[model samples]
Structures are given as structure tokens and as C-alpha cells.
Target chain A: MIQMNPSMRAAGWLLTFAVVVAGAVPWFLWGSSQLIGGLPLWLWWHIGWMIVATAIFAAFTRHGWDRYLGGIDA
Target chain B: MPNPALLSGGLSTAATSVELLVVVGYLLVALLVGLVAYRLTGTDAEDYYLASRSIGTLVLLFTTFATLLSAFTFFAGPNLAYRQGPEWILVMGTMDGILFAILWYLIGYKQWLIGQQHGYVTLPEMLGDRFGSTRLRGLVAGVSLFWLFPYVMLQQMGAGEALVGLTDGAVPYWGGAALITVFMILYVGLAGMRGVAWTDTIQGLFMLGVIWIAVAWVLSAVGGPAVAAAGLDANNPTFLALGSSFYTPQYIISTAVVIAFGVTMFPQINQRFFVAESAAVLKRSFALWPVLVLLLFVPAFLLGTWAAGLGISVPEGANVLPVLLGEYTPGWFAALVIAGAMAAMMSSSDSMLLSGSSYFTRDLYRPFVEPAVTADREGWLARGGVVAFATGTFLTSLTRPGTLIQVGSTAFGGFAQLTLPVMVALYWPNTTRRGMLAGIGGSQLLYLSHVFVPTVPVDIGGTTISLFARTYGGWDVALAGMALGAALTIGVSWVTTAGVDEAAERFAVGAD
Candidate 1:
């Protein structure tokens, strides 16, 4: 029953997908010495998704995700 | 003679005095803030325990963030990075930041709504009222306390190590532990929630500033980030890679899962759910949580990872931060970093102490021992409990059972085992008391067996009762227990149906 704006919901799912794909998989498969910002590529991959996750949450919070979904009575 | 282990290469008497003065000054400021908070808050239990549910966005955000960091992140995190390599950052830094943010939104938003409607302060209080079971409240509190004590001791032990490391054995470990314990008791007992949050905000800023400065200084001093990477690659090529021996796929995933579950179930953190001024405040905090985490963690971990490549010897892993600061930085800078680390410990310590007191006073004492106790009496009892718990942790710190990371992990594992029941109870309407109880109890039994008696075989009538001695590749005992708890809850809830309609109405997930 927890609802968000359709676009926001889609964004949330997209972010989750990104986190799962970028954060979890590459770190295990190709955790090589390829450097990104002085960190391993896989590490940067995870950090990249972390930033994306932050952005998604920021959108959710900003767009009144709970209110959009009718969870906030006020 | 001074202890060789505590002696830093560059520490002088003057540096020691400066470091001590900085640490002491920080503690004094904390006490003053506590006194000021005492004057600001009302004499009632709600005001003292929950800050009257009137916390703004920034204080709530920083308090939660600061409390979450604790001595573990400040001390053990760098040590792990130093010992294991840079992949360790993936375990705690990236994973925890992401996971905890999700949890804060999912759990915290709902809990804040529930508390606002029902006037609840503690998680157990909310759970008990939802289930209409006093025993359930006691059980949750008891479980939390069991895990929380070691965590409290971890902070004290970290403070002790930091002092001893910075002072070069001029201050004994026990002396450091005792000083922190006393200060935490006095401040927490005096200030309540208002004081704790105020101090947390200030301490959080101090920790943030000092870590950024220290990291920049260290990176610049030991050449640029690229140069540091080259040094590490030259000496230990795998340090810059993932799936290294220490960071196998299974190990990294399992550690992340365990830490995530454990961290979300921390009593003090869970209590923060009730103190947010609004749902928006909670949301804003979560929104910024990862950024804050990344800001602090990257530099600290980088410093540690680079230390190994720089050939800076870290004899004791948990002492890495202090030793790095003491030997490499100027006297005042080293002192400032030490004070910041101490701030991290103290900010967390007071919150934990306050939560522990609430658990004891509200959950245990009032229900079982003094059902008719007045609010004024309850406040006094909570303060008294703070003193008692701090003293207990101080005594435990004397043993130096393990490094900050080791002790912290054990506590984290224990708390993680509780997450399943908590989550299910919050969202699932079908979760009966039996199912809930079984979930928590069974998982704990399985977890304890795995951690303490994984291979203990007991023969009764020629039948051995040691079914808990199983191991899985890459799965930490805590994650396994959480999985088992989830299974038990879902399985038991399916066949049975017995919960109050009130519970159903109150806990309808996403049903505002």
C-alpha cells in the first residue's frame, strides 16, 4: 500500500537495480587493478552505485515519496 | 619503564601534554553541554528519554549519523583496512552506507509514525504495546542489553587504546577507560536526550573536520593518492584489487549482510526512530546518510591502506589511527585527531548509555519490580542505571578481551540476529506471538550454537543433540541466523493466526 509517484517508484527500482548490478556483481567478478580515482575499478563501481543510491533517495525524499503514495496524512 | 608497545616514534613530552589537554578539553566541553541540556529539558521521562519528540532535521540527522559511526568505525575500520587491504572499504564503507540508508527509510519512517501516534520511546515499548505482551517487551530489552554491553565496552576499550597510543604509555589503558566511563556516566546522567543530541552534533562536526584534515595531511605527506596507490601496488599488488584472498566474493557479501543487519538493530539507533520531529526529517537524514558516510570513510580507509604501502608499521591494528596521527602529524594536529576520535566514542557512548537506561527503567524495572513507580522516580532510576551500566562496561574494558574490531563484530552479530523478528513484526500482519517468539529465540539459539558451541556434541541416551554444528561457505554466523529467523517466522506464521486486531491496525505497513 505504500505508494510513491510512478516515476519516483520507477527511479527507486532503477537505483536498486543499479546497486545490485554495479555494487554486487563486478566486485566479485572483475575486481582488478583498473584504477578509478585512485581506487580499484570494482571499488569505484560500488561507490558509483552508492552515489546513485543517494540520488534516488534524495529524489524520493524531495518529491514527497511517502506523501505521493498517500502514507503521510499531513 | 614505559611500555614499548605504546611508545610512538615521534611522541615527545610536550606532544603528550598537548594531546592530553585537547582530549581533556573536549571532555569538559561535553560535560558543559550536558549541564546546559539539563537546564533546557523538562523533568519528565518523555522529555529526558525522547527529547519530547521535537528534534529538528539537523540534530536528528547528525545524532543518528554520529551514533552510528561509534568507536568501531573511527578505530576498527582503519585497522581493518590496514591489515586486510583496501577491499575492506567495500565491506564497511560502501555496503554499510547503502544498506543502512535503506533500512533507516524502511524501518525508521514507519517507527516514527507509530511512535508519534502512540507516544512510544523505546522499540521494545512499541513492540510490547503492539503485541499487548509485557513479556515480549522484556524479552526484546533483555536481548538488546545482552548485545549492547560488549558494544559499550568496545567504546571504552577504544578510548583506552587511543589515550595509551597517543600518550606513549604515559597514561595507562585503565586510566583512559576509567576517565571516559566517568565522563560518559556524568554527562548522560545529567543531560538526557537533549544534551546527548547537542553534543552529538558538535562531536560529529569535530570528527568530520579532523578526519578530512588528517587524511589530506597523510596523503600529501606520503605523496599524492596516485603515488600512494603505486607504492601499495609495488609492495602488494592485490591490495588494489577485489576478490583478493581476504575479500573473496562470499566473504565480502557475508560481512556486508551481517554488518547491515547488526547495525540496524542497535538499540540506540532504533530509538532514534522515535525522536525525529517529522517523517520528512527522517527522510532528509537518510537522504544525506550515504554522502556523509562516504565523506568520512573514504579518507580514513585511504589513510590506513596507504599506511601499509608507506611501510608505516602498525603494531596494533586498532591503534592505527592514533599511531598514524601521533608519529606523522604535528603535535597539535595529532592531538586534534585524537580528540576527534574520542568525540566519536563519547557521542556514541552517551546515546548507548541513555538507551540502556531507558531499557532498564522502562522495560525491566517498571514492569517487573516497580509497576507503580512515578515519572520522577523512573527518571532517577534511569540515571542510576546509566551509572551502573557504565561501571559494568568499564570493568569489562579492563580485560582487553579483543581488538575493537573483534569485540564490535561479536556484538554486531548478536544484534543482527534480532533484525528478522523486528522487521516481520513491523510489516507482517500474520506474525503471531508464537511465531515472533520462535523467530527470535530459535535464531538466537542457532546463532549462539554456531558461534560458541558449533561442534559441541552432547550424548543423552546415546543420542547426540548437536544439530547446530553446520558451516556454510562465505556466510557469517549472523547472516545465517537472520536467514534462519526469517524462515522460522514465515513458517510459523503460516500455520498459526493469533494476533490482536489493534496490532493489525497499528502496524499496517505503508497504511497512513
Candidate 2:
């Protein structure tokens, strides 16, 4: 199996946790009319989370996900 | 896109000509890309099916994104947003990107690894081998084919509507559908995965660029996003807020789960896992997928939502893109945007056709019908399969079963129900073949009953007895079907894990 360093594995799980918690929970943007950058507060919140999700995934891949990717285990 | 009603003030003769020219020109360019890919890859089965597993980072990323962002994004997304409000964006735009991205990482990464090891070309091949059951492989392929036929038909309908909208009814619906069907068959038949990806890249770029331009133009023309919000606030106040009364919280979350799971099992996308050059290439693509998708979806939905503020009245059940653009913008801009929408439809159609062909050739035909067939003959069969499948879907599309969005959801639901079995097969090593079989079989049985049969009945001596009738309620039937499927999968796997030591070992890692 492709191996990852301990810290990188932790980071990967951490990002996944964040994505699950914030991505699916609608309460994070509940009933807010506030607008940021000419968009609804809820819309901005979702968009902002998307950016964070991308950055976290990008970091995970760069740090250790790449190590686990190249070879087939068999 | 739905069936478009003709515009009252039709385009000028010059505009009509230009519009047709732009779409035809785009189709020609796609054909050229296919020819180039054919020259690069030849007609070998391996090269055609998997691009010889040599796709680069950029091509992989765009091809995946472009194929996923089908006519649903270009047409249904905005149309829904225009009708309901920004909440539609929440459902498809913001949520789908994140959810699908996570799935891409969780499922795609491992599939890529195993695919490289085992030379798996289809999802069923992998699953079948994992359980040491040819029946499992055939069933998986069968389920995918069943759902995919309608999905292909949906794209055909989308293309036809896009053309009709662009030309103001001058180009008949069937004419547009036939044009795309022929082009799709030719390109996919010629170059295989390489051709599809290359053309998808070009179409992907076109889809991205043209939508952003349309959004910018519309935003400027309609006095910006803030002004649009303000107008909605004045005229229709509830639209500017979070939860709508119509889109219940249960509906939102359930649909989100359904869509997220559904997308992961798409046969074309599953095949994409096998085509990644490296794990890193796949990682980069997944990491960047949400952002690329957001770039297209956010603008497209907003423009559709904002069109209302500009006083553009779209015909009920018609695509808003053409109506809004035709009324407000010049003919050239309208033509360009319409062509871009067509790109979205064609890009998706080609990939679906290609995947369907592979499933038939590798998963069903070689194993079931013609085991002694040569590799060259299999390649020819794959091409023939594409033509036959496209023709079937085209005939189905002519019937126009439902609106684009409705048919899309049905297709999505069908695919989504299979996600449970896929995940269990992938991750749960102790999952028995019986469990996998039960999961797939039970889910489909329940789903088909729910969707197709109105009630369960029995007949004895010419007297009919209704045993169970479905009740109309708040719960989405699709969500219920998926839940039942997943529950059966998990429950069966837990109870039936004793006898599959060898299968478990195989599933745990790769074949030794």
C-alpha cells in the first residue's frame, strides 16, 4: 500500500472531517440575509466553505496524498 | 433544457444564419479533435478504452469537469434558479461541488490504484472480480445500462432544445437532436477515450469561457447582482433568504445525499478513474474540481436568477438562456452562448456513449456472448455498440419523456441507489458476495416498485386485491429507495461475513 507520514495522515483526516461537518450542515447558513460582496450571506458562506475545502484538499494531496497514489499494492 | 417555445420576435435572417454557423462550426471543431486523437492513439482496444492510461493533469481535470457539467448545469440550473430563487444554487451549485469533490477523493483515488493493478475498464469488472462472481459483474453493468439509456436521452433532448432556442424555431427539435447524435457516434466511434477527452477539453474550455462572458454581460446589462437582489427584495421578498417553504430541510438534505451518491457511480466517471496517468494527476483533478465547477455553476445560476430582475419573461417550462440573451444581447453574443450550451450537452453525450460502449463490450459482450472474440473484433464491437446505443436513445429522446431536470433526477436516483453496493464492495472487505448481491438486488427491486408500480396487488379468480398502495407524503421516494438499499446492504453484510475469506482478502487489497 502507498504509505503516508503520520502528520500528513492526520491532516488528511482533519480536512475530511471539516468537509463533512461544514459541507452538509445547512444550519451554518440558516436564515441570514446579510450580503457579502453583493451576494447573500448564506451564498457567501457556502462559497467560502468551497474555497476552504479546495485549499484543504490541495494541501492534503501536496503533503502526503501523493505518496499513496503511484503504485498498485498487489 | 425543456422544449422551447418559439420566440415572438424571431431573430433576423443574418442572426439565424450566424447562430447555425456557430453551432455547426463547433461540431466541426469537435470532429477535428476526434481525428487528431485517432491519429495519436490509433484504434487499439487499450488505447481506445483507457487512452493507454496516459492522460495528463489538465486534460483529465477538464474532461471530468466538462462531462459532469452537462446540459443540466447550462440549462436546468439557471432555469431552476430563475423559477425558485437562489436556493436552487444551494442545491446544485454550492453543495454539489463540495459533496462531489469529497466523493472523487474517497472513491476515485482507490479506484485509480486498483484499476492500475487489475486493468479494470468498467466498474462491474472490478466488483465482479472482488467477489469472484460473474453474476455480480453482469448485474452491475445491467443496472448502469438501464439508467444510462435515459441519461443519454436527456442529453439529446437538451441539445435539441438548445438549438431550437438559438435559432428561434427555425431549426426543428428533431433536426438538432439528429445532428448531435450523428456527431457523437462518429467522434466516440473513431478515437475512443482519447478522442472523447480531447474534444471534452475543447468543449470544456468553450463552456467555461462562454458562460462567464454571458454572465458578465448579463450582470452589466441588468445593473449588477446587488441591484438584482434589491429588485427581488422589493417585488418578491422571500426569495432573498435562506430556506424556502417549498424546499424543505428534509428535501434539501435528502436530495443532496442522493445527488452526491448518484454522481459517484456514473459509469463514464467511473471509467475516468481508470484513465488517470497517476494518482497525483487524479488528486489534482479532484482538488480542483469544485473550483472549476463553481466558476461555471455560480454564474450560470445567478444569471438565471437575475434574469427575473431584468423583466425577462421566459415561457413556462422553456430554457431561460435563449430568452434572456436574445431579448437583451446582440445576435453574435446569443449565438456564442447557445453554442457553448450545445458544447455542454455534446461533451456529456460523447462520454456517456463511450462508457456505455465499454460496458457492453468488456463487461457484457466479451464475457457473456463471445468469449473467443479477438481483441480487434471487440474494438469493432465497441464502436458498433456506440451507434446502436445512440440510436436507441435518440429514438427515446424523440418521445421527450419529461423535462430535462425531471428526467435527470430519475436517472440520478437510479445510479445513486447503486452507490451503497459500490462503497461496501470497495471499503468493507468482510462484505460477502451474498451481501453485495442482496444490496444491489433488493435496492433495485424496491426502487423499481416505488417508481414504476403504483400499488402492489394480487389477482385470484379474476378478483383483484390491492395488498399495498403507496402513500403521497413529504418524504422523497428517491431518498427512501436509497435508504432502503443502503440499509439492506449494511445489514446483509453484517450478518453474512463468514464464508468469504478469500473474497474478503481480494477486496481488502488487490489480487496477489
Candidate 3:
């Protein structure tokens, strides 16, 4: 019901996918250092994932989605 | 005579007496603001808890910024940085700021916008609307209470320790503790949200100004942050860097993930989304928060570096800021630094006390017990809740804290675990209430087990991990808990009744 421009929706979903995949990469690939720029690489990885999380969650806020999805009268 | 360290650092009788004045002064100022601000805040429940939704951009911005800058940055950042090295500034603090911006400016700001349109009042209210379940609302409220109490205690301890150091025994632990507690309880109790916001604005400004001065003093004394870091790293390379490449990859990646996503989920922050007058204001507020957060803690890190260079012992951990302030500068300037640290402590304490009260009065009390309760009565309850919660927090702080900062991180991580399912279900109508419960319960179980068990070691494996485990060495507990919770919520939510909040989800998830 919540519609994004094909671009934003696609981008949003893509970012979400990236977050999931990046998070899971640990199951397969591991970094050599606990510190990346002074932190553990996993934490560094989470920082990257957080960006994806925020963007995807924020998509829920875009007004056009509510309107395009027919949730609002307007 | 005081211990050599104390004596060498100018922790004398006269100086200590003056410190007491600053401690008492902070409480007096808070009470004055509470008494004066009460009139402006109105007597209704809305005014008391939500300021009748009239908080301005300037005040709201500062309060929001202030609340997010917890002991993590104010004291922990520099303490850890100094103890470890400058890499944390780049790794931990930078990551923290980045993650914070994503949540506050991105996720949090947008939520504020959406809330304005939907008339969302509380976190559970928002979740309840999305899932259409009274039970979920109650569950989240319960989660908030379980974790919030310990956090409130940590803040009180932070404030109390700073007070103790400043007073140098002229004021007992309880004296400084009682002062801030009474101030927070009275201000939030009497003036409600408006008063808290106003004081937070003042408190925020005071803290920032003080931090800048403190940083300058430290830099002036030690030549600067770069020099300070270089000074320490020259001596101990192992403590400053990842000891081996073994844990490096997993540590950085996991910490970054946890901090970034885990931060915005703090309930105190969730409450802010509902309080915003508009999304635009909230966004602007968040935009400023990153730098503010950076500045607040960077100096502490640099100070830690400076302290280690001087071979200073950061006793009680919470006293890291004051001990540095008192010793690093002249008497007059040290008092100012002391004042600023007080401001930082109070800004956070006041906000949490108010937020905890909101949880009790809004999320827990009014909804489950009496849906028909008047707004005024509900507000009165919140005010009283502030006093009650503050008392509990004070009592908890009396015992010495081993890892004050870690306690905060663990509690915050537990809350972040809830963010996924709760936020997702708002848009994805197919997310079942059962999924929410299952995910949250599973995650919490894992976390509690860690609390009871010892899955990871502290101080040895990772400093950040140590920061979360407190004494138990359970940083892994939180990480595992969050990861499990997120996965289970989605996996479980998908299998159960497709919780499609057709109207809300249609806009949220685009899966309708």
C-alpha cells in the first residue's frame, strides 16, 4: 500500500538487502583485526549496516507512500 | 594528608570546599528553574508529560541532543580512549556519531514526521496502532521499565560521583546525590515536560560550554589531542591497538553494527519522536547532534590519553571527568570545568527521570489499569513516578559500580533489539503480533542467560565489549541477543498471521 517511486522503493529495498547480507557475511568471511580504524571490524560492519537500517526504516516515513498506498483520504 | 595522587592534583581542603559550593549550586539552580518554570508548563496531564506538545525547536533540539550524549561519551569516551588509545576516537566515537546520525537524523527524524501526522503519543501507542494489539503495548512498556531503572541509576551515580569529587568530602555522597535527585524530581514533578526541556536546554548549553573549556584546558596543558595520543602510543603500542589480528575483524564489524542500530532504539529517544512539534525541527536537531556528541566525549578521550601520559588513576570510573577537570587546570578554571560536568550529568539525569516517569504514567499505568483515566490524573502519576523512580535509582547507585559505562551499553543494546520488529511491523502489515512477542522473548532470554552466564571475557578481548559486559564479561550476550531478536522477529512474524495494518502498512512496507 505504501508506494515509493520505483527508484526510492528499489533503493530502499536494496539497502535493506545490503544490511542483511553484510551482517551475515560473518558466517562466511571474517576480518583479521578486531580493530578497524580503532574498533573491531564487526562493529565497523554494524555501523555500515546501521545506515541501511535507518534508510529502510525511514522509507516508512516518506509521505507519498501513505498517499500512494491509499492510506490517506487525499 | 590526602593520597599523593590527590595531593599532587590539588585535591586540598579549601579547593574541595569550593567544589561543594558548585555541587550545591547546581541543585539550587535546578530547583529555582523548576519552581519558576512550573507556571509556564500548565497543569494538565499533556503539559506535564508532553508539554501539551508545545516544545519549541531551540529547546527541543538541545534536550534531544543532551539526552543522547550519555555517560558513554561524556566520561566513558575519554576514559576508554585515554586508557586504550586514539584509535577509539576514529573507530568507536566516529562510528558512534555516524550511527547516531543515521538513527536520529534519518530513522528518528522521519518517525517524528510520521508521528505528527498520525497523532502518535507514546512508543507503545505507536506499536499498538501498527500491530493493533493492546498486549504488545503492555509488553514493550514492561521491557522499558526493566531496563530503564538501571540506566537511571547509572546517571545518578554519574552525577553523584561528580558531586562527590567537586565537594571533596564537604558534601557526602548522599548530599550531592540528594541535591541532584531533589532537583530532577522537583523539576520534572512540578513543571513536567516543559520544565525539563527548558532546564535541559540550559543544562545542555552549560555542559557544552564547560566541555569546550575543559578540552581547551587539557589541550593547553598537554599541548593537544594529537600530541596527547602520540605521547601515550609511544609508550604502549599493545594496549593502544588491537592486540592481535585474531579478533580484529569480528570486533570492529560487530561493534559498529551494534552501536549504529542499537543506539536509536533507546526508549528515552523513542519518546522524543512523539514530542517533536514537527519532523523538520527534529531533523534539524539531529543534524546538530553528531558534532555535539563528538565534542562532548572527544575531550574525555583525550583527557584519558593525557591522564595515562601522566600516570593518573581514573578512580571510581564515573569520576574520570571531574578528576581530570580538577587536576588539569587552575583553581578558577577547574571550578568552571566542574560546573560544566555537572551540567552534562544533570542534563542527562533530568531527561531520563522525566522519560522514566513518562513510561510509568503513560505506557504502564494509564493504559492497562484504566483506559478512561483523565489526562490530569495520568500526568500526576507521571510526576510521582519521577520521584519514585529517582529514589530507586539513587538506592541502586550507592553500591560501587565496576563498569558504569558498560551497564548503559547493555541496557541500550537490549532496547535496540526491539527496533527491528517494531519498526518493521509498522510498514509490513504481514508482521504478526505473535512474531513480535516471539522475537522479543527469544532475544531477551538469550540476553538474560548471558547476564547469568559468562559467554565472553571482558577487558582482554575488547574494550568496547568490556564497556557492555560491566563485570560479567557478557558483551557477546547483548550482541547475540540483538542478532537473534531481529532474525526471529522477522522469521516468526512471517509465519504467523500476516499482520497487515492495511492502512499503515500499505504506506510502511509497500507489501500490501
Top DockQ prediction, candidate number: 1
Runs of candidate 2 with Cα error greater than 4 angstroms are A1-28, A63-74, B1-12, B455-473, B497-502, B510-512
TM-score of chain B of 1: 0.93
What tens-digit string does per-residue lDDT give for candidate 2 at B384-496? Answer: 88888999999999998888888887788888889877876777767777787888898888776766776767797998755333223445566766777777777887887
TM-score of every candidate relative to the true structure = 0.91, 0.89, 0.79
As for candidate 2, its clashing pairs are none
In candidate 1, which residue pairs clash? A3-A69
- RMSD in angstroms, candidate 1? 4.7
Candidate 1, B157-236: lDDT as tens digits: 98888888887777888888887898888888889889999988888887888888888888778777888888888877
Please, what are the lDDT tens digits per residue for candidate 3 over residues B1-512? 22433422454576665555555566567667867888776765556657777767788877776676565666665666555544454445434555555555445654655566676656776776666777777788788777777777776666666666655544556655665676667566666667767777887777777767777777778776556545555665544443224225445455656666665666666777668775556545544544555555555565665677655666553466666766777655666666555555665777677767766666777778887889767766776777788898788778745466677766776676776666565545567778888888888777766565554544655564432242233234566777688788889877777444523442252122
Candidate 1 lDDT (Cα, whole model)? 0.79
* Fnat for the candidates in order: 0.44, 0.46, 0.02
Please list, in the order the candidates appear, how each scores on TM-score for chain B only.
0.93, 0.91, 0.85
In TM-score terms, candidate 1 sits at 0.91
CAPRI category for model 1: acceptable
- The segments of candidate 3 whose C-alpha lies over 4 angstroms from its true place after superposition are A1-74, B1-12, B91-95, B167-174, B224-230, B238-249, B316-318, B454-475, B498-512
